[model samples]
Target: MRHVSGLLVLAATPIGDPRDAAPRLSEELARADVVAAEDTRRLRRLCTDLGVEPSGQIVSYHEHNEAAKTPELVARIAAGDRVVLVTDAGMPSVSDPGYRLVTACIDADLDLTCVPGPSAVLMALAVSGLPVDRFCFEGFPPRKAGERARTFAALATEPRTMVFFEAPHRIAETLTAMAEAFGPERRGAVCRELTKTYEEVKRGGLATLATWAADGVRGEITVVVAGAEPVVADLDTAVAQVLERVAGGERLKDASAAVAQASGLSRKVLYDAAVAARAT
Candidate 1:
């Protein structure tokens, strides 16, 4: 029989406006035997703001100490103490700490649940003008230009709306790179300071957003990018386009590879057809 570890409650704190705080969150904070906070000071401030004093022992649970804390937390839960995990904003483990400890609890067969509350990802998607029926949450864009560009390129064919967290200072550079990877005219929204006093949501084509962000952006940012439009697979048309490129002094090999890559066709077959067409 597996050991029955105590409950692990993953709680979501308000991203901005304190009124969004759910009653369940308050109850969990006050009732749990141990409270694991990414930032203990922030958690105290939150409790102060919400008028809910935590009765449990509050401990720091953030990235820096997460590795060392997980086993200890799991052990505490195994001893039958309910542990509540919270972050500065949003839920624990979404580009935040608590994921490692959650895994430990799962591995130990510990009881686990969430005190659901505000999430910046969902809030941004809800307000983003882009399609929301299907969407993906990418934690954050890479910092380096080349790495970030490659990351966007990998999602070039993704047809679901994409959400990404980003730093205020990096928004302009990131948007510019996204414009290049996803196309200048692709639609997206820059949701800033979500639910805060200075909240702003800017919707426009990638190019336009890039231009606007160049002047700079501030606040907690969530960027929603429209999925890449599905390419109509027409190999015959692709071959003709390749031939056109060839006519413009492009090598047959380069044109064939480009068309085949974009259309998911056979490069060798495209090259053969181009050769046959030239002979005719």
Candidate 2:
């Protein structure tokens, strides 16, 4: 590959097992003028395992500091520096700190490249046993109860398989909420500690998974939900759900809004569907 001048290299580190680290990653780490890592300590350990020491400056770049560090990283790259960005594991900026920096580089008109390696997203999606042809990653959901419910509700009718990252403590609650919003029988998978020694993947209906998670779980968790099955025009069902929400004290417009948002159908579409259902 031609050497990319002034490129922001987004390198992927091994999610686990140092041996999984790619040869190109080590080479880039050694050759780059600046290395922006999500966790500098982890990067140092990875370097030790790879038997390659970074000769250039290594700077901390993570969620808390990404906004502050983006411009500095962009400036270096624009100056024709080869800047490598890495996260604690997997690809940087995928639910990591690299997005801001990558966006900054693009906005600054700097070249960008990648040394792709392990990705939990693809790994889980591949093993998920769900349709992988089309999918979306909805990182972590809101931590608060109401917001999380609303978020999941918004995706209740999403037709594309959905992937999510959830902390161990909240996985059960998230699964429960997902079951309630997407339906208990919706097929899904919960992958924990992927690519690690104790890696485990539990696949089943949302309700079953929620039950298993109720006792508590641990390690990094990635949830893959099968997309919603296409629903035929059932004006009766639509009207019933709408009336139910409204009966629960939601205003007509608010209920319609919730249904529209969740189903990815326009409010006007659902409103018309609801009206037709009530007439029938």
Best by lDDT: 1
Q: Candidate 2, which segments miss by more than 4 Å at Cα?
A: 1-4, 234-280
lDDT of 1 at 11: 96
Model 1 RMSD in Å is 5.0
In model 2, the Cα lDDT at residue 1 comes to: 30
- lDDT tens readout by residue for model 2, 1-280: 3335688999999988888888999999999899998889999999999999999999998899888888888878777799999999888888887888877777777789899898888999999999999999999999999999999998988899999999999999999999999999999999999888999999999999999999999998899999998755454566678878978998878888877665556678777776676577
RMSD per model, one decimal: 5.0, 5.0
Q: Which candidate is the best by TM-score?
A: 1
CA lDDT of each prediction against the hidden true structure: 0.90, 0.89
Judge candidate 2 against the unseen true structure and give its global Cα lDDT, from 0 to 1: 0.89
**The 10-residue segment with the lowest total lDDT in model 1:** 228-237
Residue 85, model 2: lDDT of: 94
Q: Compared with the true structure, what per-residue lDDT tens digits does model 1 show for residues 1-280? A: 5656589999999999989999899999999899999989989999998899999999998889999989989989999999999999998888999889888888888889998899898989999978999999998988998899999999887889999999989999999999899999999999999989999999999999999999989899999999877665676788799999998999999999988777767889888987887788
Clashing pairs in 1: none
